[model samples]
Target: MNASDSPRPSALDWLVEAARVRDAEGLHRTLAPRRADDGVLNLASNDYLGLSTDPRVIAGAIEAVQTWGAGATASRLVTGTTALHAALERELAEFLGTASALVFSSGYLANVGVITALMGRGDLIVSDGGAHASLIDGCRLSRARVVVVDRGDHEAVRTALRERTEDRAMVVTDSVYSIDGAVAPVAELYAAAREHGALIVVDEAHALGVRGRGGRGVVDELGLSGAVDLIVTAVLSKSFGSQGGLVAGPTTLRDHLVDRARSFIFDTGLAPAAVGAARAALGVLRAEPDLCDRVRENARRLATACGAETPSAAVVSLIIGEPAAALEVARRCLADGVAVGCFRPPSVPPGTSRIRLTVRADLGAKELDRVAAVVTRARTAVAATDAVRR
Candidate 1:
């Protein structure tokens, strides 16, 4: 038979087959609509401070909509920049004790914009091997010579920076890893960066609004705030319980990103409502620093109940091994009156698939008890199911 005589599969057929493989592994994902008044205990969301549904936050969003008319209209450099945006930037910088801050449409964009804007073909980026997807993509897009060190391996990062042929180097890490919830050795990493004369960028997406003084984040907690050379990126959606992101650093860094970062330069600005809500959320944070302690306490309770390590923040992981098993446990928890996160590979390494639980500051004893019970029950059920299959 001639090679040209063979038929090729349709694109839809290829997709269907790929989906079948995922389904077989219980890795298929679907969107489920969640209601505001569902009354279900939420241990799945990233609202560490439980400020999302606060009356004040809602009021702030409403006020912003009324005053600014919803959209930002254009890019920041265009007509998109607003007084609210400026205010949020100023306040966030002051809160984190950074010299300046620049807002972006999302955290991913902030990482991409900051990294790409600062580095290029001749520059080097030594990223943590387990960095968020956004940081990885930024490193790839920056056209920089990229090196990945083991997560929190300060010595490896130092060596990479020192050995790099590039004149400029940047070391990137998460203040707290998104998956395992492990806190990064930020202080040591910063020390390495300083020794090697490399810039350090810490993504505080999972750290902000959970750790530090009044949720200022790990940077401030380490007393490294106002370190002009250290750059920090954070999301407003998680702990702030709003939308958008920010890159906080020195004035020159912010100016460089504004001028050269395509993600910031070309994208439409963040909506007015999100800006107002985040700003108001900061007010809530300042008024109630105890909420940080509350969330950490909740996280510890959940972690202790699950036999996991003492949590560094509000996130805890329950490793279930298989994607199907993890999914089953998450569904079981939801059925048992609680919602939890299910992570699968490449979201997590194979054989380490698990459900990530974010213990909100508002979760009470009743909620915590239910979560703990469901998890234990789910594990037993999963073991039984596996035994039957075997």
Candidate 2:
């Protein structure tokens, strides 16, 4: 057929087809913003300390806006760097016991920056199989030879490192696995990396405000302060109850990142309000280190109540083993005025559908009891549905 005679699919056609595929698999995703006064109990968010709505944090953001304006007008390389950013960096480095720190717009960008900047085409990157999506993306973007070891396998990491033919090697892992809420064997992995002359990068997203002294993170908790070659990233939106991310390492490494990391050089700097709120949150953490104990206690309590019936950690994931059932349970919890997370195929490994509930320090006894009741009810409903299907 002639070029003019041939039918061409419109640009929107692909989107429609994609939506249809998602609908068929019940995998379609949608965003529903929560109202400021929503009465629903939240067990889905990553705000472990529940400081997102704290008066101090809000006041800090307000003060920052008044002093430094709303948005960063340009990238950090241009006009985005402010006194607040510098202060946050300094305070963060001191808190984490790192030699230097570089703030990024988000945790995802921080990972992208670290991995790609440090490892090039000839280098090798050995990562945990269960590392966060951001780290996986960073490895792909780095153009490095990426090898994913078994989840929490220190020996596999060592083997991978030993087998590496590249001149430079790096090992990456999360201190806490986001989905299962299981902690990684960071000390063993670090030792293995050291033995092989490979640098270690730990993402302490979930461990930052939940582990270590004054929530200094897993590195501090393990007494590996300033020992690991590099610690890549964390989301301020989580425990900090703000926005932005950070990379902490040696002064020379950070200086190299500032010059080479594309994500830091090209992206806009963190907004003043986020920096201020994070700073305030860090100050609060320093003052009330007991917040860490409360969060840990809440998690342990939930895990104990669930017993061997549910998966562990601050994140108590109830496996349904079926996507539709998991979704239904999540819906039931929501209808009962408790919001919990539903993880299916793409998010979880295939066939590991689960309802992931994250515990927070702000969850009072009454709220915890309510959540327990709702989850039990949801579980009963799923069991009944399964029985009927059989």
Best by lDDT: 1
- With a 3 Å backbone cut-off (N, CA, C), the pairs that clash in candidate 1 are none
TM-score of each: 0.96, 0.96
lDDT to native, each model: 0.92, 0.87
lDDT, candidate 1, residue 186? Answer: 94
> For residues 269-365, could you state the per-residue lDDT of candidate 2 as single tens digits?
8999999999999988899998887887887777666553333336787787878788889999999999999998888887889888888988888
Per-residue C-alpha lDDT of model 1 across residues 232-251, encoded as one tens digit per residue: 99999998899999999999
lDDT of 2: 0.87
Number of clashing pairs per prediction, in order: 0, 0
